[model samples]
Target: MSIDRRRFLCRGAALSAGLLLAPGWRAWAQSAPMLDPAARQARAVRYVEQASAAQDDPAYRAGRRCANCDFFSAGQRCSLFPEHRVSPDGWCMSWTSE
Candidate 1:
């Protein structure tokens, strides 16, 4: 197997182990609601200012956004905030230009 795949599997195992050991994690997992990508993005957008232009903030350049930011991954989620899907046009305090 490729190193990347191995690493991914390892991380998944670690995460699962950690969650299994944490008290109330199973309950939380079972009870927590899941949101659609749009809803998740909407929730995430509350923390990040949605910007069309860099003028919205000093951190942003004319075209900077979650889709182009360093923290973004898989075209949908942000590494900086893993709990929800982030909008491609969203700009947050943690934004880092790629």
Candidate 2:
């Protein structure tokens, strides 16, 4: 029957609610893994197609992949985009490719 009054009250209520929710945003902020950035970066596959020529190259053919590596975040796919996401067929120097 009276739309103007209800609309004004609703807007005021929403504004107050949003203002109250603002300070609480910190609680919703995503927490990082326990591992440091260096450790996280280690999982990011940067070099995939080549092998190191060093006398003792750590890169191997088996058990080495972006998915199997510890550096790879659990439930996470590729370390490259972290979002584009890829499979373990994946390999890279960053491959922790465990």
lDDT of 2 by residue, 1-98 (tens): 65798899999999999999876653432232322223445345343422332214365555565567665544444445453333434555654521
* Model 2 clashing-pair count: 3
- Candidate 1: residue 57 Cα off by (Å): 2.4
Runs in model 1 deviating more than 4 A are: 1-49
Measured with C-alpha atoms, the lDDT of residue 59 in candidate 2 is 54
- Least well predicted 10-residue stretch by lDDT in candidate 2: 29-38
To one decimal, what is the Cα RMSD in angstroms of model 2 from the true structure? Answer: 12.1
Count backbone clashes in candidate 1.
Answer: 0
Q: Using TM-score as the measure, which candidate wins?
A: 1
Residue 87 shift from truth in candidate 1, angstroms: 0.3
Give lDDT: candidate 1, residue 17.
89
